[model samples]
Target: MAKITLKDLSHSYLKTQSSDADWAVRDVNIDWEDGGAYALLGPSGCGKTTLLNIISGLINPTKGDILFDDKMVSNLNPVERNIAQIFQFPVIYDTMTVYDNLAFPLKNRKIEEDKIKAKVHEIAEMLELSSTLNNRASGLTADGKQKISLGRGLVRSDVNAIMFDEPLTVIDPHLKWILRSKLKELHQKINRTMIYVTHDQTEALTFADQVVVMHEGQIVQTGTPVDLFEKPKHTFVGYFIGSPGMNLLPCEFKGGDVMLNGKKIETHTKVKSNNFSKTEIGVRPEFINFSSEGIPVKVLSVSNTGRHKIVDTQSQSGKIKMIAKTSEDIPSGSAFLSFKKEYTYAYGDDWIIE
Candidate 1:
């Protein structure tokens, strides 16, 4: 295993880059510790795949260096970097049997036949493909074929790191969860450095020890799943990481207080300065409650999502959403909304105020 590092990384596909908008990835610096499970997460076109390809040596950055275990590898090809990359679709040989597909890498390196058999069988068993070892790769289901692709990477012992680029994109919805669980289990069992790239929050949160959230070619935050949900450092992080996301309300900073719709509100952090072009207060729907005496709102609608109710209300300042228990009573017509101060935060220019 190796600790991967990207130093001041920036990439632009254009021959003559004119501005930040021309860059696919920008000023990215990250150290993925040995044996760490990480996910590069964001919406589509957020540079997740570009960064992954750079790490795996598929693309050399236009302006920076990549290192493996502190050794510069910016110019190395994918094979020279000793990394395994599983793409969005399965890349196995269709004519090969399942067993042969898993053993192909080992055979290419001329590993002993007995050792190859042992390793292939081991990975096949872990991926629950042991029963289909003799079947032709073309005959398996999409999920099964993807598992074979995964096993081919895991079967190789010399890989410094394993990178997955939306490996579950072609998988069925129900099987996606099962494959995610399998991947997590494999990571723990093998203890190899793994980088997963995906836009799906559930996949990133469930599979990664650290989620690197990217937005517009820059990393916005890197944190544990709980940290990203509870203390988002950017408004985009707040708006992207959660179901229903966070409610950002336009507000003003007054004399040592935050005022929303002319009502003083408490927040988790104090605004250090009021020099921002835009200012807002961010609080998740899960942290807001209907109170008897707070910011008054006109109840707009309520949606029952089986386990909980999503209440939408229009405060004087803006729309606010709150998650309520199914048993909780939601007032009709009008109600007052209260934000949990410990969970409420102040933001300036889209970044959290320290």
Candidate 2:
């Protein structure tokens, strides 16, 4: 295992990049500790894959260096970097049996036959594919083939790091959860440095110790799942990480107070300066509650989702969403809203006011 470091990383596909739009990845610097499980997360076209490819030596950055431990590997190819990559689709030989497929890498390195057998079986049992060891790779289901891809990466002990690029994309909805759980278990058992790239929040939150959230070719935040949800450093992080997401209301900072629709609002963070071009207050839907006396709002809709209700309300300033208990009475037409001050935050120019 190796500690991966990306120093001032930036990648542009164009020959002559003129603007930020020309860059696929921008000014990324991260230190992935040895044996750490991390997820590169974001929406599509947010540079998640580009950054992953760079780390695995599949692509060299236009302007930066990649290091494994202390050695600079910016110019090394994927093979020289000793990286194992699992793709969205399975990349196993169809003619080979499951055992042979897992043992292919070991065989390529001319490992002893007995050791290869032991290692292949070990990975197969962990992935619950022991029963299908003799089956042809062509006969397995999509999930099964994907498991083989994972096993191939695991069987190799010399890999510097194992990187997954949306490895569960083709998996069925129900099976996705199972595969994700299995991946987490494998990471714990092997204790290898693993980097998973995905656009799904659930995958990132559940499997990774740290989630690197990227937006528009830039990393917005790197934190634990709870940290990302509770204390988002950017408005985009607040808007992207949650189910109903956080409610952003336009506000003005005046005399050490936040004014929203002519009403004084409370927030945990104080504005440092009012020099920003845009200013807003951010509070998660989970932090807002209906109150008898607060900001007046018109209840627009209520979506019942079994245990809880997602209430949509329109205030004078903007739309606000709140999560209410299923048993609680939701007032129709007009009601008042209150934000939990401890969970409320002030923002300027899309970044959190610190």
Candidate 3:
């Protein structure tokens, strides 16, 4: 295993990049500890794949260096880096049997046949493909074929790190959960450095110890799943990481107090009168509740989702959303809203006010 370090990594596909907009990835510096499970998460064009390819040596960065275990590997090819990569789709030969498919990598290195058999069987069993060892790869389902592709990566003991790029996209919804669980289990048993790239928040949160959230060619935040949900450092993070997301209400900072809709409200962070273009208060829907007296709001809509209901309300300042238990009574026409003081945060210029 190797500790991967990205030093001021930036990549631009254009030959003459005139501005930051042309860059695919910019000014990214992060250290992935050895044996750590990490995920690169964001929307479709957020440079997650570009960064992954750079780490795999599939593409070299336009700026900065990549180091593995303290050795500069910016100039090395994928083979020299000794890393295994699984793509979005299965990359396996249809003619080969499941056993041979898993053993191919070991056999390529001229490992002894007995050792290759043992390793192949071990990985096959772990992926729950031991029973289909003799079956041709052409006959397996999509998930099964993908498992074979993953098994090839695991069968090799010499890999320094394993990287997955949206490996579960083609999987069925029910099997996606199963495969994710299996991947987590494999990571625990092997303890190899693994980097997963995906647009799915669930995949990133559940499989990774740390999730690197990227946006518009830049990394916005990197944190545990809990940190991302509880204390979002950026406005985009607050808007992106949740089911109903966070409710951002425009406010003003005056005399050491937060004024929303010309009324004072409490928040955990004190927003000073700074020269910011935007000022707002952020509170998760989970943290907002109905109160007998607070900010008066007009109930717009309520969506029942089994155990809980998402209530949408419009205040004088802006619209807000709150999550409430299904058992609780949701006021019909008019209601008041209260934000838990500890969970409320102040924002300036689209960033948390610290």
Candidate 4:
């Protein structure tokens, strides 16, 4: 395993990129600790794949350096970097059996035949593919084929890190959860550095210890699942991480107090900024609840999602959403919404105020 570091890394496909919009990945500096599991998460076209490719040495950056354990390795090829990368689609030998497919990487390094067999069996059991060891790769399902690809990467104990790029896209919903859980289990048993790239928030949150959220070719936040949910550094993270997202209401601030639609709303942070172009109060649906007295709103709609109900309301300021428990009461015409003091955040421009 190795501590992967990206120092002032930036990449662009255009030869003479003139603006920030032209770069596929902007300046990003981060250290991925050895034996740590991380996820690069964002929406489509958010440069998640671009950054993954750069780390795996598949694409050279337009600027900056990549270091593995403090060794500058920006110029190294993928093979020279000693990292394994699994792609969105399965990449395996159709003619080979499942056992041979898993053993290929070990065999390439001329490992002893007995050791190769042991490694293959260990990975196959971990992936629940031991029963199909002798089965031909061409005959397996999409999930099975992908498992082989993952096993190929995991079989190599010498790999500095293992990177997966949306590897579960083609998997069924039920199988996707199973595979994600399996991956998490594998990480714990092997304790190797793993980087997963995906747009699915569930996959990212469940699999990674630290998630790196990206937007518009820049990394917005790197934090645990709870950190992203409770305190989003960027408004995009507040809106992107949750199911109903966060409700950002335009407000005015004066003397460490916030005024929303002429009513004072309490927040945990004291935001004092005079030069911001916009000011807003951000609160998650999970934190907002109905109260007899608070901000007045018209109950626009309510959606029952089994476990919880999502209530949409419109105030003079704008639309706001709140998550309610299944047994929680909901008024018909009009109601007052109350935000938890500690959970509420103040924002200047698009970033949360400290």
lDDT of 1 by residue, 1-354 (tens): 789989999999999988889999999999999999999999999999999999988888899999898999998898789889899998889889999999998888889999999999888888999999999999999999999888888988879999999999999999999899989998999999999999999999999999999999999999999999999999999999998999999999987689997889999977778888999999999999988899999999999999899999998888999999999999999899999999999999999987
Worst 10-residue lDDT window, candidate 2: 268-277
Task: Give each prediction's root-mean-square deviation over alpha carbons.
Answer: 1.5, 1.5, 1.7, 1.7
**Cα-based lDDT for every prediction:** 0.93, 0.92, 0.91, 0.93
Q: What is the TM-score of each candidate against the true structure?
A: 0.96, 0.96, 0.94, 0.94
lDDT of 2 by residue, 25-137 (tens): 99999999999999989999999999999998888799999998978999999878888899989888999999999999899888999999999998899999999999999
lDDT of 4 by residue, 1-354 (tens): 799999999999999988999999999999999999999999999899999999999999999999999999999998889899999998989899999999998888899999999999998998899999999998999899999999999898889999999999999888998889989989999999999999999999999999999998999999999999999998999999999999998999877789897788899888777568989899999998889899999999999999999999999999999999999888989899999999999999888888
Clashes of each: 0, 0, 0, 0
Off by over 4 Å in 3: none
lDDT, residue 5, candidate 2: 91
State the TM-score for model 2: 0.96
Please provide, for model 3 over 1-354, each residue's C-alpha lDDT reduced to its tens digit, 9 standing for 90 to 100.
789999999999999899989999999999999999999999998899999999999998999999998899999998789899999998888899988899988887889999999999899889999999999998999899999989999998878899999999899999999999999999999999999999988889999999999988888889999999999888888888999888998898887788888888898877766777898899999998899999999999999999799999999988999999999899999999999998899888888887
Worst 10 residues of 4 by lDDT: 268-277
TM-score (C-alpha) between model 4 and the true structure: 0.94
Off by over 4 Å in 1: none
